[model samples]
Target: MRILMGIFVLAIYGGITFYLGWNLRTWLLAIQQFRWPIAYWIGLYAISFGYFIGKLHPLLTPFSIVGSYWMFFLQYGLILCVIANLLIAFTPLTTKLVGTWVISVLIVLLIVGTYFAYSPVIRNATIEIDKPGEDMRVVVASDFHLGVLSGKGHLEKFVQLSNEKNPDLVLLPGDIVDDSPKRFINKGMGDVMQQLQATYGVYGVPGNHEYYGNEMKQFREAMEKANVQILMDETILVGERFYLTGREDLTNKNRLPLSKLKPEDNALPWFVMNHTPNDLDEPANLGVDFHVSGHTHKGQMWPNHLITERIFELDYGQRGKNDMHALVSSGFGFWGPPTRIGSRSELWVIDIQFAK
Candidate 1:
C-alpha cells in the first residue's frame, strides 16, 4: 500500500514537471540556440540520469525523489534563456543583454554569499508565558543541514553564534545535518559539538529529513557526541519552573506517539518542541505554554513564502493565544539550491517570562 501511494505521488509530481517544461518550450528552444551544442547535450543527459537515480532510491534523496532541485535548476536556466531571447528578439535600443545576464548572475551570487556569510548570526526574540512569576529564555535554530554544504566551518560559526546568545536553554528543532553524521565523522562536527555551550543544555528533535534516509540513529549519535540531548516522546524538568517535551515527526507515528504528552503537574509552564507545526490542537488542549518548530523554512525562497503561509497557521513567526503560543523559525540553513530569495535564514531567541 505504501509503495502504491508513493508511486501515485511521484506520477503526479512528474506530470507537473512535464507540464511546466511544455509551457517553457519556446524559451528552451531559444536558449538552446545560444548554448554550445555538446555542453547542452551533456547537461540534458546528466539531468536525466539524476532523475533516474533519484527514482530508484527515493529514501536516500528526497530532493531527487521529488525532482524539486532538478526542476528548480532546469526551470531557472530556461527562464534566463527565455528572457535573453525576448530581449534580443525585440531589438530594444538599450539592449545590453550581456550586461543584464551578468547582473542577474551577480545578484544570485550576492544572495548566496550573504546567506552563508551572515548565517552565523543568531536571531533573538522574546515570548511571554502565561504563568505568573516565572520566566525562561530559550534559543532556537533549525535546519542546519550540516554536511557537504555546511561543512566544518559553518558548524563552527553556528556554535560561536549560539554561544554568544547565552541562552538559558537551546532548542534544535531538527535537520541538523544533510546526511548521516557518521559519513562526516572526521569532518570536525564532533569538535564543533564539544564547543557547544548552553546554560540549560541543548535539546533536539528529529525532522523529516532525518527520517528520509532512516539516518536518525546516526544523527542521535552525532548529537550525543556534541553533548546534545535527543528527546523522542519524552519530557523533562528544567530549573523547577518549566516542562520540556520533544516529539517524533508526525509521519513516524509507529516510532513515537501522535497525541500530546501530559505533564505531571498541570500548572507548570510547558514547552513542546516538534519538527512540523501540524497538530496544534493536541498541544493546545493539553495546555502547552509554547510550541517551537521549524520545518517550513518560510519556503526558503520567494513566492514560496506565500505558499508556506497558506499551508501553515504559524509559518515563520509567533501565533496563537497567550496560553499557548506557536512560534516557527524560518530556519538557520538552506535545504537545496543553497539560495534564500524572499526569506532570510533566522534563529529564534525566545524569552519566556512567567506573569506575576
Candidate 2:
C-alpha cells in the first residue's frame, strides 16, 4: 500500500509537470535562439530547489526569494495555463490560434495571480463566548512565511495592522517564519515584531514549516527576540479568564494528545491556537470556546483551496459546533509566486466579546 501510494504521488506530480511543460514548450522554443533550452529547464528546477539550500545556511538567504518565485512561476503559472487551455484543446482550432490563446491565458493568469499574491486581504470576524468577564479582542495572524519571499516589508505591515486594531491579544497560529530563522531575524523581523502592541500579549505556535526547515532553536530564538511567546503543548491563563491552549504541530509525533495538553479545569473558556485545522472534532468536543489556527493558507492559491477544504473541518473562515468556535485564516503572506487567485491573503481579526 505504501509503495502504491508513493507511485500514485509520483504519477500525479509527473503528470502535472508534464502538462505544465507542454504549455511552456512554446515559450521555450521562442527563446531557443538563446541556445540554452536544456540549461534553462535545468536551471528552473535548480532555482526552485535553491530555497532549501538557503534554509540550510544563513548566508544563502538571498537566493531563497529568487527560488521561491521560480518555484511558483513554474508550478502555479503553468498549472493555471494548462487548465485554461484544456477546453480549447479538444476544439477544432489551427495551431496558430491555439498557441496565441494559450499564451494569452497564461500571461493573464500570471499577472493576476501575482497581484493577489502581493496584496493581502484582511478578514474580520466577531464571536461571543459565555465566559463571565470583560470583552477580549484577539487578532490572529498566521503563515506569514517571513524569511525570503516575505521580508521586512511584509512583517512591518502585519505588525502595524495588528497593533492598529488594538486587540487585547495577538495570536500567531503558525508558520510565522518561512524557513531560515537567521535570515528572518537579520532582515529585521525581530525588530518589526517588537513594534506589535497588544493589551495582553502576542502568542504563537509552531507549524510544520518550523519543523520542516529543521531550525527549531533558531525559530525559538527569533520569537524570543520578538517577544512573542511560542507555546508548545501547553495552556496558559490570560486576562484571568481565558485559558489559551496551544498545541504542538501534528508534525511532532510525540506531541501530547489534546486530552493531555488541555486545561485541567475545562470550566474556564478556552482559546485554542492550533496550526492546521484538522481533526477538530476532538478539540471542539473538549469545550474550547474559540479555536484559532492557520496553515492551510486557504489553498494559498486556487483549486488547491479545494483540496484543503476537503481535508480540514474548517478550511477558511469561521465554523461552530456544539459550543466551540473555530476560525482558520487563509494567512497574511503569500507562500509562493507572490500571488493569490481564488483565495485572499488574510489576517483574521476576531472580536471575542465576553457575555454576562
Q: Pick the lDDT winner.
A: 2
Q: What's each prediction's TM-score?
A: 0.79, 0.87
lDDT of each: 0.70, 0.78
- Model 1 misplacement above 4 A: 1-39, 47-72, 78-121, 132-134, 255-260
52-144: candidate 1 lDDT, tens digit per residue: 455464354543433334544544544555565566678662335443563477467546745743465556567676676456667898887
The pairs that clash in candidate 1 are: 125-349, 131-355, 132-355, 133-355, 134-354, 136-352
Worst 10 residues of 1 by lDDT: 19-28
* Model 2 CA lDDT for position 224: 90
Best by TM-score: 2
lDDT of candidate model 1 versus the reference: 0.70
